[model samples]
Target chain A: MARWGMVIDLDKCTACGACMAACREENNIPASGPELAGDGRSIFWMDMLTITEGEYPNIKKRMLPRPCFQCENPPCTKVCPVGATYKNEDGLVAQIYARCIGCRYCVNGCPYNAKYFNWYPPRFRDEEKRYLNPDVSVRPKGVVEKCSFCAHRLVRVREKAAAENREIADGDFTTACQDTCPAKAIAFGDLDNPYSEVSRLAHSVRAFTLLEDLGTRPKVFYLTEGEKHGRFKI
Target chain B: MDDSKYNELDEELLLRPILKTGKWFYISCAILFSIAMFAVWVWYHQWSTGLGVTGMNRPVFWGIYITNFVFFIGISHAGTLISAILRLCQAEWRRAITRAAEVITVLVLFFGVFNIIVDLGRPDRALNVLKHGQFRSPLLWDVTSISIYLTASSTYLLLPLIPDIALLRERKTRLRWLYRLLSFGWTGTDKQKHRLEKAISVMAILVIPIAISVHTVVSWVFGMTVQPMWHSTIFGPYFVVGAIYSGMAALLVAMALIRKLYHLERYIKEIHFNNLGKLLLVFTLLWFYFTFTEYLTTFYGSEPTHMTVFYSKLTGHFAPEFWVMVLCCFLIPLAVLVRKKTRTAAGCVVASIAITIGMWLERFTIVVPTLVNPRLPYPRGIYHPTWVEWSITAGCFAFFILLYMAFTKIFPIVSIWEIKEGRESSVSETADRVKTYLPT
Candidate 1:
């Protein structure tokens, strides 16, 4: 019923990578270790895409953080042989790690390259183990994982709302990445609520979803970085 | 009645492989068994550890296992579809070769399915596909179609083997009990013959579509994905053609070996090779046509996302594999098979080996290029298969050959009864049928 969504404004964003760090800390994703990382096996839930535009001396660089699109018409969910990945009524794409057969079909199906697989059993760095969020699951070896839009926070908020006989408010379900953004560049709330700041920002002309022409209709919208910043403006 | 005179020689040749065991059989089996065992151990290590034991990583989540899955399934197309098509067309030559082809279909399919299981990150939870199957997935479509194909092809195989088993039963082979149980009390009665013929025909018709659909669904596993180069309309027919091409090559390889080892040359014949070579040539041309159109369309479109993958295969990191595939699947095949002079059994086998390797490369190029160059900006993923992946792949091939060898020993690779029927009935029936095609 919530139709949860996110909007990231490029102008304010500094690409600090605090969001990525916070996501793993909250979601319990592991550091795949240097050996595995060299094999291109780095595990990330929230990640960044670095785009280098123009020639060497004239180069312009942009770093855009990427989260699961939580697509309205998800290519990933469509191809899961088991119902391990599905979009809930709240319009959030959810992965059931216990049910995942680790076929990686969903990973291949994602156009954004947003998903990561647990090549080894979930490993936590010594300091990471201390901060492992109890509410989040430590995914087993071999299952695919991605940013869940911080759905666990929503569950806790929902339970609290239910106990108080009140409906969940838009800001009550913000993702860890949105909360961690020092620039306040990330906004998350119920997209269905027209009055919500996230929804208002999503309506901005600069806001666009990745690979939108493919019609995935991602709930995650990115506000274009530079238009008046220079040329590369759509 | 005079058929017994000719059948005696045919029986001696075809049945010798079954009646007598060879020293090479033990030696080869020993080699194959060890390779398969090593692969098993590697798979065990992967299970205890993780898929990281293989060379697979992000982006390249699939590798040789998926390639083998597609390749073996393509190889499987060699038998049932070809045999069924030949049988339906009333090709008399099919009588000697159909059983061998059908055996490949039945046995090779298991490994095709096995490759999928081996590729899984959570193979232990593979049953989840069955428990919570969503038909919406192309993978579920693959499961359903391949399972039907395996069942239908194996039954189709068993249906035609009853009369052969009866022959072996009468001969009192060492596996008399097996022959008896499998023969279904087949007697040479007119009623039994008529029923068997009808059943075989029904299965022949049924198996063709099932075979075609299996490969089509296999292609859809990629086609349904919106990945660059993979989302194409032609993938269904393209995959089916490739499957048949590689399958025919595998059949030739197997037939050549069967002929050499068991000395089935007289029965398998130069003429059979000649006909199959011509067929292989046609497929080679078809394969080239599909590959040409597939790439040419992408190149022409110049769609940036697709061009990245397209250029990767043509002139980039995958160029070596891509060009070699063209050489193997098209150029070499066209050279060896096109000229009638060099289309001998040996020539066919050489071309077949090329085509098999080429087809495998084709599968790898198709799977990897798109994944490596992700749609979003990231470092292009690189894949180098670990020893575990290579060992398992080698094991599957050895395992396939080993099973095929065991099948040859247990059953007459060439159908005895079909050969007899061809000698007795097909000769007269062809004359009568050809008469109808001509002016009286």
Candidate 2:
């Protein structure tokens, strides 16, 4: 059995927001125009958060990249009246858009605010429509969507591995964010395999999960910058 | 009392709305119906466009629709629960008020259910909650409990109306068939009365828990979340108290309005308002107690995210609304009802109106502030309800009034037989009971 996980090294992250862009492009997330975005209607499955600490010249800035933590005990799944969102056996938090009634209960339940609602019909330029990913279904208005860890890639990888009659390779499947990360900050793989890079990185001393005390047991891990680095004092 | 005089009073008071069609009634109905139709058109626009027509956004996904849902549901608590409790206690004053209260419960609950549908992004898929519902979710609990409460409340409302329906049927009014179908040949025999009394008693006992559970479950829709201010052990009882508080205020307002408009002052007397005002005062204190405890614990514990929401409500963006709520729900009611001089019928009316507004604000405060300041360090999301949302809200109120108006025309707003029963039997029965209690 595979337990997919991710490890994002905050020290390596540049806050370039490419991961957000890549996730949106890969997942077919809607584009809310500037007017709607100003109202906080923008959809970003992977988001970049910057925290500023201290005043004046003593200030330091820290950047945090956030995606769905895919908690082992997902609060969002627990409150979904229609069972539209659920944690799969392979440890992926999956959202069935067709089943979603768009009550927005799951959107509110998510502690990390990873979920996004399609407030309007997804907008695509005439040229951009041709570039829409065929593998991924374009979600209609009135459903929730979030980062799926590029779960479709996993499906393709699994099919290839099965046809080749061999075990799935760690390097074979990577999330779009992981693939597009300029600094190679995000690592994705089966956490159950100790030999996997994600498992090794997750075991590092500085490795932590966002809101760890929430007891969501998020599959996503973060290796924080060491104390000698410009980690914010606060 | 002379039977002829009593009969004349009944004929004039109870039958007036049915027998007579005044110009004011037609005008009010036309106005209310027009506003309600306009709201329906707005909803149609939303259905054609999307939820984006409203002010809801990423983090603050729930807006005024949810606020109205909670508010109307809380208003529903004013009906069957209060009426049932009063009936169980054999309070004589309840005879003039229970029908109005129960009607409010039924009509308001319909609006409450509609608000949920209006809030849904895909209202067409709403039945999926039943078709593929997961029982584990608090939302499912809400669906289950609310449906049960609605059924129980409607049945409870109908049970007492049988005798009245029979009365209307006998009179051969305009809607005679409707009354006959509803009356079920209720002949007012001893057996029939005994059955009706038994049913009302059983329902009175059954309805309290269902009514309590309905609001408690509604609270859980927020409380069960890990959101800062919403996750509280006190939410169940707190919401129940709030519901009853708001419900009492709604009932008083309705009673006062009916009294003035229908010339029901002789029946819905000053004493009813005074007693209901005192009850409102008790709930006001209770609501304040819960609010104090809820906020005090959050303030003292000072969990970073929780404190953000707490401070936001206390001294930040939500402060004005929060303070206004306190003033309307607590200060005004406390000042008015605590003093004998100001606890007049008019005074109670003022307090009731204040509490109704206060309770609506309370629901808004509870829902929005927490979402605006999420656990994550996102910028505070601003929620300004769009005109569409406002129109829908206005429409809901207009619809409720229209339904209530139609109901008053069809049936006696006060339970005629119950009042007659009370007048004829209770005086002698109370004397016997008082004698039995003396030196026993």
Candidate 3:
């Protein structure tokens, strides 16, 4: 019965890219070799986008960290021919790799371009293989993959809470990105629970979702960097 | 009917290809088969190595594979729309080109379906679309419509062929058993003729809407998506119109080739091409109208995301291909076809060839430009198709022609019996109808 969500506070964030690195480590996303990376085949569950505003002397750099928005009205899932991708009751958009025909219809339908396709079989260096996260399944070539909000960690936390006969607390289940953010900018919790930090931050006057006019109803909210920093247009 | 006249019709038109095996036929077959085999090898390489062999990436997930899928499927409309509608309207010239058009429909539909499989990342898992297909998806609608169209069009092609098969069986050709098996025990009895006519008429009527639905559903595969340029109310009609336009052009090209190669100049005359040229002119004008309205609305509305795609085609990397498409699909066809003096068989052939290429580029322009310019700016994706994609595409075309050539050898490319029927009975009926139209 939980409507899980994430709220990212832009004011506190530094463009350190720790979240992206942590996500790569936590998920089994393969490293596209330098050649493929230059070709824009890099697999990133968490991505950092840099925007440059204004002319010469007045220029400012703003870093935006993007993960899947996990929309309640997901356009990607709607276009998938097979039921390869679907939104769970917990508000996480999940992909079933085995069922994916790799038609890439979902990839085309997605407006945010959050989805990534495995063009080649995932490869990890011999040493990196030992460090691969055991909780995540390595995706095969030809299927699509994307951020899952560390739903595996949420499952572990839920099991622990069930064993203790206690409900999951606000801070119990956090995404790898939320856990690794050095500035403590990312907050993840059940948005339906008013007491949760994500819920409270989501209600802030400055909070907004990307492409809100598209009516995707994204659960990932962004709290604007206060009046001093210029408002993010997109 | 005069016995010598009937014998001459059968000997000159229907039996010549079946009875004789030219060296050129074998040579062409060898070349086409080898090219097709090379394409197969390229596909196997892609299957083993993964889709990374192609030039597709994040935003450009679909490229030429999807383009070919749409292009071939659009070409399929040639047979069903032209043959079926012409049959329904009782156009006498249709007797020469109907079988050719119908054959193109079935063979091109096969390759159209094949292209989708080649595009899939997990072709092995393609059956999952049947097993766990979501009806909400436009792709499911495509599966349903295409399957129906295939079945209906194939049946439409087969129905008229039965009487011809009976004729071939009576001739006792080298493949006597094959003709006997296919003829389905037709004796040319009045009852059998009536039954065959009923079946053909029913299928002819049934196939038109199914053909229309197939392209409309294909368009919805893009239209139903929330992607910037693809999500439009006009896509369904636009795609259907484009399909018919391209299909007409393909039919013209096929007719011209069959007329020349098979020496059926007497059966398929200048008048047939001239009539079809006029039809092509109508489609050319209509295609232009649709293209004009589609872009004009996109430009006038000036939605930012739509504008990105609009400008990408109008002035960006796709501009050259886009203008070429305009010239091929519209201006050249218009210039050649609108003028009565230039609307010769050769002119029609040239115009049709241009439209076929133009329509293919039109599909490419529709699919690639939208994806390269994503709604959210990460980077503008570039898609440069590799040899693997190119080979597979080449293979698909070769396979289509090979199948068609093989079909021509085994069966009559033009419906001989229908031509006979039109010659014997339609003249009297047509004269009577014409008399009614004339002032007393």
Candidate 4:
């Protein structure tokens, strides 16, 4: 009955892409190199956006790590033709690979650009294959894949918690990105728990959600640095 | 009752003598069917290899498959709406065009539904739509509405044709067995006439809303999304207007083609083209208005997510296609249709093709541009169709043409019974009305 959420502190973040790489590896995402990137072939689950403010010399650049917001009222799930993608009870958007008709309506419906389609069959080098997360199933060609909030890991964490005869603790579950942040600016916990770190941090004046006008009611919150005006560009 | 009047009636009733067996007809059909089979082969390849074969990618996931679906469905709307509207208005000229238009609607509906399956990654599992469909999804709405529209349209298209079939059955003694089966025991009695009138009336009334719902549901597939370009309230009426616009153009094209092929220039005169062109012009303006209103609101708001997609369509990667759609769909067609000399059958033919192609490009522009411009921007997504996608798309067109051609051969493409009824019912009724209205 716990609702998972994340608060990313923009102040400590220095735009390092280590979180991106770690998340990709942890999720078993296939890397799409140069040839396919602009041609609609690239597949990146968590994409980082750079938004710059002010004129040159006084320019301030901000890096925003973007993943699926996992909206409570997800537009992506509403348009899927075959029930391939759906929002679970815990508010995590999930894809049912076997049922997908690959109509790509969900991909088109998602405003976040969070979803990635497998253009060609996934190409993994020998080392990359060895590094693949055994817990997550590798996606085949045509079907879409995106950030599942490390759903597979959550399952393992839940099983462990159950074995201990207790519910999941505040720190028991975390996304690959939240666990890998070098700056420790990211916090993940149950939003349903008032005592949880995510719930406490989400109420900060520095905390705000993206595209609030869209009415998506995203579970992910971003806490700005609050040091400079217009510091967070996008 | 007089001999002279009866002979005049007979001549009017038989516009053109029905041509029964022909070797060339059979040969052409076989060739077309074979081509359709080849297209099916390409579709099978797509089924196995996945969408990777097509030019479509993540952002451009729709491409030709969705475009063709919209195109074919738009074309199908022509017959039902035109016939119903004209019949309700009591337009006498509708008689000649109704049967031909109805046939187009039925054939194109079949093609439209087939194209969706062709676009599916797992078309074999299409049955799951009924088995496990979610009511909240717009896609499920589309499935339900399209089926309902198709059923209502087919019935509407065929009900008027039955009397025509019966007429053909009465004349063709050699093929009595075949006619007897298709005639559905129509006796052409006063009671039968009353029953047929009632059926046509009910179908005509029901078909209009169903037709509107079909396109509205299709738009919901895009509008229900939170994607910047697609998430507009205007999408419902906007899509319906586009459907009718393209549908009208398609009807005009079919009329021209049928007139030429069947040498029915006398029946399908310049007036029909002129009237249809005028209707097309109205739609062209309406389409422009909708596009302007939809874009102006998005532009004025200047929402970054909306602007990214708007700019992408207006001056970015999709600029060429976007402008081309505007030109072909509205500007050029309008120019050609406005002038009397260019509003001829040939001119209308060119315009119809333009409108059809333009509408398809519109779908592509709408689907792909928004996808490339994500809410949280990454590197812009790119889409290139693989050969399999191209092959499958081509095959779908071939399949449609094949179905239409086959349909023409199996039944009289020009509904025999309807034409006879038209010929039988038209002149006398007009003369009676004229007689009643004349001052003594």
Clashes of each: 0, 0, 0, 14
Q: Candidate 1, which segments miss by more than 4 Å at Cα?
A: A225-234, B1-5
lDDT of 2 at A220: 93
Candidate 3 lDDT tens digits, A1-234: 889999988888887999999999999887778988977789989998667777989998777899999999999999888989998767789999889999999888888899999888998988889999999989999999999999889889999999999999999999999999999999999999999889999998879888888889999988875663335533
Per-residue CA lDDT of model 2 for A1-234, tens digit only, reads 878899999878888999988987898876667898898888888987767777979987778888888899898999999999998877889989898998999999998899999888888878778778888998888889888888889899999999999989888889999999999999999898999999999888878877767788999988885673323322
lDDT for residue A101 in candidate 3, whole number 0-100: 94
Q: Measured by TM-score, how close is model 2 to the native structure?
A: 0.98
Regions more than 4 Å wrong, model 2: A228-234, B1-6
Q: How accurate is candidate 2 locally (lDDT)?
A: 0.89
| TM-score per model over all chains | 0.98, 0.98, 0.98, 0.89
> Which DockQ value does candidate 2 get?
0.77
lDDT of 3 by residue, B279-356 (tens): 999999889888899999989999988999999999999999899999999999999999888888899999999999
Relative to the true structure, candidate 4 has a C-alpha RMSD (angstroms) of 3.5
Model 4 Cα lDDT, one tens digit per residue, A68-133: 888887878887766779988777999987777666777777766678777566888788898898
Query: DockQ for each of the predicted structures, in order?
Result: 0.77, 0.77, 0.83, 0.55
lDDT of 4 by residue, B1-440 (tens): 54213344442333343444357656866776776777778777776776666777666567767777877787777889888888877677786787777777887887788878877766777787887788888889989999898889888877876776676676644556776787789988999989998999888888899888988888888888777878789998998899888888878887897687656775678998988888888888999999999999999999877888899999998899999999999888999998989998989988999998899888888877776666663556676656665666666666666666555544555554545555667678878888998998
lDDT (C-alpha, whole model) for all candidates: 0.90, 0.89, 0.90, 0.78
Residue B218 displacement in candidate 2 (angstroms):
0.6
Candidate 4: stretches off by over 4 Å: A32-38, A52-61, A121-134, A227-234, B1-35, B168-179, B384-387, B431-440
The DockQ-based CAPRI class assigned to model 2 is medium
